[model samples]
Target: MHDSKNALSVQKLIADLAGIVRIMDQKDQQLAPAINAPSQSWLETWMTAFWETLCREWASIDQWRMNKVLLLVRFFIREQFGLALEWAVKQDPKLKDQVARQLRVLEAWPLSPRERRVPDGLRLHVLDVWTEELAGQLSAAQKALDEDAENSDPESKKSILLSLAQEFMEPVRKISREAISKGVKIRAKEAVKLAEEQLSG
Candidate 1:
């Protein structure tokens, strides 16, 4: 009976994650054209009014993307990992100690400070790194989860998930915020550069 319950829980979690991924895919499709649109011509770019409008549009799109990613992270933490950890603790009180230890390790992990300066022209690269890091972590977690499900030990599987959650939750949020902020700064700098070029020309 216990094994059956664990199996069902794992299946449900995987299904939920799959559904979220599908939604994200749809959003990506919707956003891709706008994000990948060609840059404005030099003449249009020189107009201060047009430049300001472009900056706003780009910032809005970037913020929307960041918000979606953050929402997914929050959903994973609250709906999936949080509930699973709570269930595990209720099932085996001894597991709480292990969770605590894992959390301590996570807490000790060095997080890049939120206010760290992002170099000019490197914003997109930094954002890519942040996005890749989160994607890599999620992919690794999913793989580990599949491996854990194959094992006969339900407690061990829950422990592993809990550890993964502890390691990722805060870092994901931090990186998302940093990425969004850097994107905004990049847009501002771009606007200024456009104005400068216009004046120089």
Candidate 2:
């Protein structure tokens, strides 16, 4: 038996499972093959356990597992497979609220399911409503870079922020490419550049 304390590290597993589950949840249903794939049996076993764990967690109606919930939202929006998400939501009515609106946005405007197989670093062609959230995160990172007056010098702090920003910029690039193809305006072109500098400098 798995250790009670370490049996699954359900919390960590939830976070790690984010990438795999998003493929299962995306409405693209065709992408199911990508996420459903695993070289190891442990993956299938873990996901099945996660499914059951989701039920256990649902009984308590807790939001502590929200990271996994967010990942599930990604799967529903981007993955080709819809069954895993549908099954999960059907199993737990509570999961509906966290992901339903996002799923609606995806269904409202979807791109090629095959594109989902591309790494998130390369495949995020466009973000629907989620851009606002991404912007907020980048903005917060910028503010931290600008406002660390109390803790560190601006240049040093900026170096940290720049590194953070650069890491974020790659996704922005993909989003911009995707959005441009779809004819949506980008909100943070400058922020993307700033992050690039951070990443390189």
Instruction: Output the number of the lDDT-best candidate.
Output: 2
Question: For candidate 1, lDDT tens digit of each residue in 43-74?
Answer: 21222232233334444445434544344334
lDDT of 2 by residue, 20-79 (tens): 655444433343356754223332334445444443454453344444454553543333
Q: Provide the global lDDT of candidate 2 against the true structure.
A: 0.40
- C-alpha local distance difference test of each model: 0.39, 0.40
- Give the per-residue Cα lDDT of candidate 2 at 65: 45
How many clashes would you count in candidate 1? 0
Error of 2 at 33 (Å): 35
